[model samples]
Target chain A: MKKQLMTGVLATLLSSTTMAATDITWWHAMSGQLGETVNTIARDFNASQDEYNIKPVFKGSYVETLTAGIAAYRADQAPNILQVADVGAATIINARGVAKPVEDILVESGYGFNNQDYIAGVRNFYADSNGKMIGMPFNSSTPVLYYNKDILAKVGVDAPKTYEEMEQVASKLKEQGYATFSQSLTPWIMFENFKSRHNLPVANKNNGFDAPATKIMINTPDMAMHFNKLKDWSDKGYYKYYGSDWDANQTPFEKEQVAMWLGSSGSFGGLRNRVDFELGTTYLPYWQSMNKDAGRTFIGGAALFAIDGKPKKEQQAVAAFFSFLTSPETQMFWHKSTGYVTVTKAAYALTKKSGYYQEQPDAEVGVKQLSLPGGEWTKGYRLGFYSQIQEIMHREFDNVFANRISVEKALNNIDKESQVILSRFARTVR
Target chain B: MEQRQQYTHSALPYFLLVPQIAIIAIFFFYPAAEAVYLSFMLEDPWGQSSLFVGLENYTILFNSTEYLKSVVFTLGFALVVSFLSLSIALLLAVKANNILHGKGAYKITLTWVYAVAPAVAGIMGGFMFNPHIGVFTEIFASLGWDFSLYTDPFDATFVLVLVSVWKQVSVNFIYFLAGLQSISYAVNEAAMLDCESDRRRFWTITFPLLAPTGFFLLVINLTYAFFETFGVIDTLTSGGPGGGTTSLVYKIYRDGFIGTDLGGSAAQSVVLLVLVLALTWVQFKFVEKRVHY
Candidate 1:
């Protein structure tokens, strides 16, 4: 019995010395080249730290990974960190004990993280109702106008700025026998980015940032004009609606069949490589002719959250890893690797000093589009049941674009349908 | 019956039954019980927390237009997939059986399609039918027919149905070939000597004899269409062009897993369970009398 006790103690000591670094699993959804970049980030962070080891597991797509993390948490095997899409921020936060607030992590650790260093639009998205950070903004992207220079030159326009001007330009280009624009019919550009660009409230109560929004504000007159404009222009062959998302939308632009393509900044690297045509990217068109209070767009990618119920040591290790990711140097590598927007002001400044933007001007467009001074509605919208809401939005858009209903009726119907989801979600959360 | 032997050791029987019972209990009963329990409760996606809300989830599902539409959609999809796959496979098996030369080669070629994954088959269909890049779409365009699967609901559903039928044809084909081959050549020669036409012999003599196999395949194919067509639908259309192809199973996955409406999704599953149970029961009760066996 004495020998057995001594052997157990010796084994414990051996493990303590050999396995000094605490293991913290990180579940993420990045795939392909972006997946490689995620691994590189973890490897760099692991090399930087002697205390914590982060193991990044690729868990399918965004929805799949988020579901896996949640399923893990339910099974009492959740990882230390989970990378979930920005849409899931509210869902994760609202879930009573699913995630540990990043701000709380920093406060407890007393780590010197300058919150002000984060870009305002990106930072505001992951903040809670009290303006406290809940998730780390990682690989954030926003839509930009990708135009063919040759087509714009033939049409005698530099770059269209407002909705009305774009309409005129599209007409001119079509008259010259070129289809003016082709966009992915996904809700990211049509719903979220459009709302942000026009400073319109997509939902009530400060776009659901201040509190759980009680109503959807997508039926406002400003929203109608944009849809109406798309309707009229689409009737005149000014636009082509591709399949539901970015990869599908890039096909026409890659084929040089369309002049204008509005898509995510994350596709910048691929867009540059695929197109032989002289490509020029500009800001997503605003409705300056309608709403003068329009503001800059917000981020569209996923963020990292420190999951709850982890050991204290594992939590600190996750916090340390997050700090390393948020550093300017690591952020630079991440931005260039994925063509996602730079998350930190210091990172942007350092990239500027490095003359990366001057070397590749296409990378500068998304930053310029999103880094504008804030307006009343500049902060992004978050609500529960957004996945359901997104599907409804797609269906309602088809109603208008497919000639089943007028834009006016479609808008009203969508509002009513969205309210049903909102009310049901309100009940579920309560 | 006359040679039946009773087990002298009762414990031996229990020991022999242990693995099967344990497996069924663990794999099937436990999950079913959990789903039934969750169907009555409002829960988070992770099942981290739940509120017992009685039958509210079922009520909400009943009231939901999307759920109602998906029910009709699932019925139509299963009907189309089952009928098309069975009929097409029957026709192919008949043709292959009629051919005397290279019969093995013909059967082998047809059966090889089963090796392809449903998603991979859907993707192959995409390569053929995609409007922008498809060779078939290009042909249709030249013939003055516009084809855009992504933009048209019927086209989207057609693509899903086509891919699903393509994947399932092999299983149906194997069953059908066995059934067709089981019919004796002596019967066919006798029917011909009796002066019956080829088509008439197939319809009047051979088809009735094959009804048992047909009845068995009908049940299997319906189940396959109802439960196993998710990969095809997801790959080709993602149940879109506005939920045109969203079956009951796909909707459950989207809501429960992707949309994170656990209670609602569970409620959907319970409703689906009752539906399938009723369907299968009716098929077995009434349809079995038509079988020759």
Candidate 2:
């Protein structure tokens, strides 16, 4: 009886310790301040729950992290959670059997999952047609206008509310020898913003999310007008065409060389830290003459994905942590820290009640823009083979910027390349 | 009995070489063979599965206009960079040979720059050429010229070739210096007795003697231009301004990694391998034959 009691006591100790904690590895690409925020959330979650411990690892940049995850998945050594950029959404969705749906995991774990709680646009991109959420929307943000208030005041121009006013301001700034009025030539900024604001279809079949095999719809007259205006500005020395993307332009703007910069709302935090001069934020300027009813800009930041290859118990752990991530407290913290829009309506309300926005007014811009009533364009484009399409778009835009091809020819080439990619994607999806 | 012993000793060297041969076959030959095999297959991006497509990938690569343009551009770039690097290296080697003071310091400093990572150098070069804030750009602007190297194809090529030559000059200079040092002082005395001009003496004696080193450098510089410059190209232009700055290897990276057309990229790789092999063989047969060594 004594020997049996001793054995039972040892077994009880082992069981208690085993039940005390389960470790889950989350690989993410957030660095610096953002990495600290992720760590804080993980620590809080670990402390709140005695059952599971979430370990967050800082992988490199977004592209590097995604590539590493893909390679690791192929090798059957993938992490439980991965942070993929917005462009990677379609790629992750198409990677069937490689990822677990958050909805299914939640339901299996007996945690009540609701799709309606999330912003429809943000939630739908990560969901299947039957409304299964594939990933949790984390670190989401939309583009906004950032202007140097000092430069604007010096040029005697208010922050431009309309595209025409922006043009006038740009001309005045150039005339006043500001060197550069604005410094980005990214298509997502120049083209996607225009399309979203005017409610123009960027692609057929609700920007190719409803149907994966949709052709490019960006060769319209309005797009031509946008390109022509940019070209005119380039010729007139009113605008300085930086390279193709944000990084190339942000350097000059950070140095206070450029007068205005159109960038993601998440950039508010970065500008607040980096810029010595006073900075002002505004909604992206729209073409007033084209349509009176222009909407918010498309979202640009990334979300979190739950990869496959874990057991049912581990999946439950992931679901729990994901729930904790999307919880009102975590979302509010993320928004207040990073200037990303709160993914959940409750988090937004919580932030408002806490008067976080009152302390930092620029934090409210992302929410205001996303909350606008403009239909599908506001939802942002989702398409299969999106990575390939984005590459083609960047390349053809490079061609235009290089003056190797006309805007019409470049768009036409993009249309052809996109169709080819779309057709291949169609074959697979079908 | 002596002849049999000599044959056994000669055969023992072959036996000794077996391990090295096996290692080469396992590591290098196996992967090269697999790459060749992969050239005939189509890879699905999402599925990451490859299917046999025979010559279809090669056909696509051949028909690609961008690939054709890249081929021409890469060849021209390689030639220009190789010649420029060789010339500068030879000049520096001669100057170092004549220098009486701080010769070791100069050599060490140049060699140290070569040891620095190409990616770091490329980044520094990018900053130095940045149109808005770069010191070089400001100076060029003051001279009344637009110095946007990132946007201009000619300027991009110039920067690429300049960086490539700059990075390589130290290596080639070391090789040439060693070759120059190896030559006997008797040759110079003989030329002096013949009363030849310095230029003529160099052309007739020093140049001919240094042919072996020059030939070696030519091959080394060409290969460097082909493979080693990818980091510089990626960091500097990212094959940008309408793919004007893309070299052959850069195109291979784009096609395989970014384009997700692994088979097509593999086919292009095979073509590149064949071209390099053929060129090397030609250089050995024709150019190396002229070397005095």
Candidate 3:
């Protein structure tokens, strides 16, 4: 018995010495080149630390990854960290005990963390009702206007700043036999960006930040007018409708068939390489009469969240890894790699000093637009099932452009349909 | 009187059936039974909490215009895809059987598409029907047809049906070819002697002989349309332009997985299960009896 006991003790010591670092699994949805960058970041973090090791797993698309993380949590096989989309923030936050607040994690781990270090729009997005940080902002993107400068110069007009100016430019381009604009028929651009920038509430309860939003306010006159304008533009052949395919507009934009393309900020790095001509980016157009000063647009990418129920040591490891990620050097590397916004001010400053924005001026447009002062309505949506609601918005709004439904009718349908989802989500929350 | 052979050792027979029964129970019965149970309750996204809503999910689904519309679209989509694929496959098989030269080449060329996965097929179809760069779009445009699959529901549905039928035709072709070859040469000669027209002989004699294969393929195609074409619809249209092409299964996935409305999605599954069960039963009961061996 004494011999066996001695052997066991020696084996424990040997194992402890060899397996010193705590293992942390991070499930993310990034794919392709972006996925490779994620691995590099994790590898660098692992190399820098001796106490904690982060293993990043590519878990399909954003929705699939979120589902896998939730299902894992239920099965008690949850990862230490999960990367969830910006829209999924509300759902994850509202799901009690599913996540440990990142702010708390950092403070408890004794990191000199400041919430103000993150960009305002991004910081507001991943924060709770009481303004506590819920998730560490990672890959954030916003909508921006990309215009073919050659085509615009041929039309003899700069990129539009207001809705009326956009119409005039569209007409001007139409006369030149070029389609004026094209965009993804997504609520991220059409609804969320438009409403938030105009300081209009997409839902009651300050776009669901103050409380659980029960009513959808998408049918406001400002929104209806915008849809009406899009329909008119579509009818006049000023705007090209590329159906529901996300990458359909890229061909037209690259071929100079369309003068302007409203695309995600993250697409800048790729668009720069794909196009041979000079590309210019500007802030998303707003209605001048509605708002003299436009509010900020919401972020559209994913953030890293520390999962609950992990041990304190694991949580500390997650915090330390997050700090490393937020550092200016790592953020700059990630930004240059994936074209995602540098989440921290220090990172943005470093990127600027490195002459990235000077070489690619369009990359700064997203950061500048996102750093604009945000109002209560512009602090991103906190409604549950927002991803599905965004789908509904896209579907309904696409019908208007298709001439199958009127703009008013589409808005009415969106309001009614999204209400059911909101109510169901509210009920499901404990 | 004829004596029927029976298993003398009942335990051995039962043991022999255990693997199949166990697989069916674990894979199909368990999940299906769980779906039925969950359909009657409202569950949260994380499944941390659930409420016994007692048929509220069903009521909500039945009352919702969107859900009902999805059901109708699913039925219509299945019928259209199955009918189109089977007819096209049968026509190709008959033409190939009649051709003496390059029969093997034709058979091999036509049956190879069965190797492509549904998702890959969807992606290929997506590129081919892309509004701007797609060859089909350019062709249709030159022909003065506005074939924008992204904006127009009709255009999207057309592309979806076209892709689905194209992907599904290979399996149906192989089955039909096998069925055609299995027909006795004597029977074909007899039909040729009796019939004056080739088309009439094909319709009257050859079609009846191929009825068993047709019936089996009908069930298979319907099941494929109902469940397997999800990747196609998702990749092609994503059930958009006013939910014009959302199949029941697609809607279930969107609701259950993306939307995270578990109870509602479960209810949709139950409805789909009932629908498929009813369809298969009716086919077996009413249609199979007329099919000759």
Candidate 4:
């Protein structure tokens, strides 16, 4: 009778320890300072409640982490939370059985989601057809124009706010023998950001949100003219081609060799520490003919996904952690440390009230740009295999910049090639 | 006379071979068969949805101009890299074998690059050929050459070949050096007595004897150029400057992993496998005859 009592006591101890905390694993790509911020948020959440232990794991770059997560899901070892890049968002979302919709998770956990709580551009980007949130927006960024103040001052021009003004400023700077402008060969800044800011559709089917995108829609006259203008700038030596390497132009911009550059707002905090020159930030220029006011710039960073097929208790833990992530305090802390845009209005207001924007006005450019009124086309890209499409764009754009192909030919080639990829993706879904 | 082992009839011999066969079956045959099966089907990135579209992937690949261009580029790249690396390494190996002073140091220095991984070599090459602050870029600038790897296809190809050949030469060098050292001293002395010129003696004695090694290295170098250069291409150019440097292996990787076009990538791998098989067959059937044992 005494031995039986001891066994009962051991069983009780084991069960109590196991039931004390539900461990929720989060596979993220954030590293360095950003990684530290992620860890802090996890630690804070763990400290606040003992029911869920939010475990954050650094899983390499955005691509590597997404690949790992997908492979893990296939093997039935997926984490509760997986961070996927903005481009890979479609891939993750299209895998219907792989992800548990944020709306469902939140509603089930008794913390219901309000679409209005998130910035329209951000919330809409991760929303489904019925406008329900599928994933939680975490680290978001938009491209903005950055210029060297002393170099622009020498050319006697303030930072150009429109495409026409940018060209005029380029001409003026060229007259002074300055390499007036440069940008990375990334289609993120040139195509996606440019199209959204000009209120143009990148692909058909309402930028692929209404249905699976079937064809390329970037062959319009407006796109031709915009590309031609860039070609003209290149021919006149007013614009420098930094090749396909994304960070190549950073050196020239920092060295003041290139007067103006289009760069990610996430780089603002790091840039301020890296450069010695006076820097200026502005919204990316839009074609006035297309839209007098700039449309909202889409977010570029990754979002957190709740993997499906986990236990209800585990998913509830994930939902609770996501609520904490969307809280204004966590958002503001993330923005301050990483320079990623605040995804929610409350976070923006809270950050503003703390005087963070006033102390660093340049950091406000990305957030402000993201919060601008947006049209149907201004929502983030929802195309499948978007990164691969970007690679095709990179190759063709490089061809144009190298003088090997004309702009029209390059666009046509991109259209034809991207159509093939889209059709293939569409075939799978069908 | 040496006794001929009749182990072919024994179950013990077969049992002994089980591990090797099992490894080959698991590692090679299974993946190859899966690739063949996948080639006929279209699948999404995560294997969530699949559609069996027989011959469509291959037909599309053949019709696609981009794939055709990549095929031509890959073939040309392999040929050039193989030829250049073999000849260069052979010359260095011969020099090192002949030299008595600092021979050990020279050989060690030449062989050091073999220890570096392909990705590491690509990274080092990337640093040296970086457009903005690369050492080679500065050198080219001083010489008044308009050099930009990101913009110029020729420049990109040149850098790719240079890095690939540099990475591969050390392995070929070790083989050639070993081949040179293995030539019997009596044969060299006899050739020295028979031939008046040192060059003539080398061509008559050393060249033919080293043909076996050269033949082996040619196959190795070609295989390296075809497949092993994926990391170098990925890190240095990522098959850029209008896809001028993309090889078949890199394309398979880009299509499958990056683009998530599983069926298309699978078809590409099958094509590559066939191409490699044909090349090997040709080499062993035709080229091996010229190589003296």
**Candidate 1 vs 2: which has more DockQ:** 1
Q: Which lDDT values do the candidates have, in the order given?
A: 0.83, 0.79, 0.88, 0.88
TM-score of chain B of each: 0.93, 0.92, 0.96, 0.96
State the lDDT of candidate 2 residue by residue for A1-430, as single tens digits: 9999999999999779756677788999899989999999999998887788889999887767777787788778888998987776766776567778888888889988888888645666577655678878888887778888888898898988888888888788888877445645366677666688788877777776676646867677888888878777777777667656457678777787778888888878878888898888888778898878887666667877888769777788898998898889999999988888998888888999998887788888877887676765566666665666676677777667667788888778878777866665554443
List TM-score per model, in order. 0.94, 0.91, 0.95, 0.96
Worst-scoring 10-residue span by lDDT in model 1 chain B: B1-10
Model 1, A2-86: lDDT tens per residue?
9999999999987786499889999999999999998998998888867888899999999989988888887898989999897
Off by over 4 Å in 1: A1-18, B1-11
lDDT of 3 by residue, A314-398 (tens): 8989999988999999999998888889999999999999999888787888888999988878777788988788888878877
Q: Model 1, B165: alpha-carbon shift in Å?
A: 1.5
Q: Any residue pairs clashing in model 3, and if so which? A: A243-B150, A243-B151
Candidate 1 chain A: minimum summed lDDT over ten consecutive residues — where? A241-250
- Higher-ranked by DockQ: 2 or 4: 4
Interface RMSD of 3: 1.4
Model 2: residues with Cα > 4 Å off, grouped in runs: A1-20, A178-180, A183-185, A255-257, A428-430, B1-19, B46-49
**Candidate 3 per-residue lDDT over residues B1-293, each given as its tens digit:** 13434535459778999999999999999999999999988888888789899989999998988888888888888999999999999999999998999999999999999998888888998888887778999999999997888778788888888888999999999999999999999999998898889989998989999999999999999999999999998888888767888999999999899988889899999999998899999999999999989
Candidate ranking under TM-score, highest first, comes to 4, 3, 1, 2
Stronger candidate by lDDT (1 vs 2): 1
> What is the DockQ score, from 0 to 1, of model 3?
0.69
Tens-place lDDT per residue, model 2, B72-93, is 9999999998999899889888
Error of 2 at A45 (Å): 2.7
Query: Candidate 3: which docking quality band?
Result: medium
The 10 consecutive residues of candidate 2 chain B with the worst lDDT sum are B42-51
